[model samples]
Structures are given as structure tokens and as C-alpha cells.
Target: MASKTSAISASLLVAGALAAPSASPADNDGRRARGEAALARITGAEGRTVVESIRRTSPELGDWIVDFAYGDVFSRPGVALCTRELATVAALTALGNAQPQLKVHVEGALNVGCKPDEIVEIIMQMAVYAGFPSALNGIAAAREVFEKKGVRTTAMEAAQPVAPAR
Candidate 1:
């Protein structure tokens, strides 16, 4: 009798595993394709690999990152990726927990047409409002990205030419 009960329990577990509604392959494909498209749109082909890595490491979070962030929020009719990246940079920089991601978004910001100067200015603004520490960390993070891309910080300073004395 105990053996029969154990067999029945095992059968039920197997059934449950078979019946579990996993994310559909088509759905997964669509999400992945959209994610790639969105990443390409914002960061170009070179940066898409990084975004793909993010997806592979955390499938569940990747779904939200791709489907929700890139698909739903980013695909909204009016808001461009550049604008969204700016907001993402600011939010991440302000939160200060996800500095790595903030660095990626800094590159995303540049890929989507945000001038380096604009990003530096945003970091400076965060320093004043979000506190010096957050801003300092944000600058450090952004600097890593700039260095990786072979962009010098002086370019940002040069872009914003100071007015000469009257």
C-alpha cells in the first residue's frame, strides 16, 4: 500500500512538471528578438552583445528587462530611446545601487545620440541634487564607459566651450 501511494505521488509530480505552463517558445523568441532590436536601436550592434549577456544570465529578470523595459516602456509611441536612456541613467545614478548598469546605460545614452557632454552634465546635476556621493560614483561609472569607448573626459569639457570675458 505504501509503495502504491509513493508511485502515485511520483506520477502526480511528473504530471505537474509536464503540465506546468512554461514561457512559450514563440513568446520567448519574440521577447528575445524585440530585445535585440531594442538594444540595437539604442546601443547599436557592438553593444547588443552586452545586453544579450544580461538576458542570458537572468532569464526571469531578462524577460522584464526586455519585454517590459524595451518592449512596453521603451516602445511607447512618443518617447524615444534616447530620452528613455537619459531617464534610466538618472534613475540608476540616483539609486546608486546599480552602478554597473548605470555605466551600461551611459554608453546606451551615447549610442542613442546623447552627447558625452550631456551625460557629464547630467552627472554633475545629480551631484548637486542627488548628493555628492551618488554623483561622484556616477561620474566614476561614466568615466569607465568613456574610457572603454576611447573617449576622453576633456571632450566633454571642450564641447561646452566657456564664454570669454566680455
Candidate 2:
């Protein structure tokens, strides 16, 4: 019985080792390509502008954005791009201090086929976890992005103050 257990453990160890991804130059190149493609798919024409702006201040940071954030993480399979963008929006909203990034992700979410209302829903959902203030700020950012794109949503109407009964 012990011998059988040892054999099974050895097999499992070998399987785990085989399943792990090895870092090679070719693998890195592939990851970079996939990441760039994913970023381009999400950001469209704005990708260059975004990366260039980041590069002007921190080139390494810019590369990591493209290579790690986009490439290693965003390019992974399973979750849809639209879902990923929404998740990003949610995370940024929860952070409450990344308005610029939140706005950019709001735009990215729109680009990836997320409806304005869906963006609103995600921001509103963040309120439960991140508090009313964070949700309010996030919704405001989403509203700005929507307005810039000439898109309208129920969230926009919600942003307006109600008049008291005369």
C-alpha cells in the first residue's frame, strides 16, 4: 500500500511539473504577441496613445502593461474580453483612487461589447462591496466616458436630481 501511494505521488508530481509553463524566449515572444493583440483588440486606435503616454514617463511600466497585464493575464483564455473589461472596471471602481484608469477601462469595456447599462450595473454593484462613495465616483467616470462616446444610459438619468413636487 505504501509503495502504491509513493508511485501515485511520484506520478502526480511529474504531472504537475509537466503542466507548469516554462519561461523561454520563444514563449515570451508569443506572450508578447498575444498581449499586444489583446490590447489592440480592446483599446483599438487608443492603444498607441495610451502606451505612448505611459512610455513618456516610464517605459518599463509601459512594457509591463502590455507584456504582463495584457499579455500574461488579459490574454489568458476562459473569460471573455467583455467580462474581463467589466471585471477591471469593478476592481478600479473598488480602488476609488484610479479614476483615470477607471475611465480608460470604462472605454475599454465599451469597446469590448459591454453595454453602457451593463457598465452602470457593474459600477452600481461595486457599491455593495466598495461603498456608496466608490460606487458614486465609479459611476461618474462611466458617465463621462459614455457622454464622450455619445452614448446614453439609465445611469445618466439617475445622475440627474429629482425636482420636488410643487
Question: Model 2: which residue pairs collide?
Answer: none
In order, the Cα lDDT scores of the candidates are 0.78, 0.89
Q: lDDT tens string, model 1, 23-104?
A: 8532754755676578678766655566567668876665676676776666667877777888888888888788878987
How many residue pairs clash in all the candidates, one count each? 0, 0
Candidate 1 global lDDT: 0.78
TM of each candidate vs. truth: 0.68, 0.76
Give the residue spans of candidate 1 off by over 4 A: 1-32, 44-57, 153-166
The worst-scoring run of ten residues by lDDT in candidate 1 lies at 24-33
Per-residue lDDT, model 2, residue 24, is 53
Candidate 2 — worst ten consecutive residues by lDDT sum?
22-31
Best by TM-score: 2
The true-structure Cα RMSD of candidate 2 reads 6.9
Clashes of 1: 0
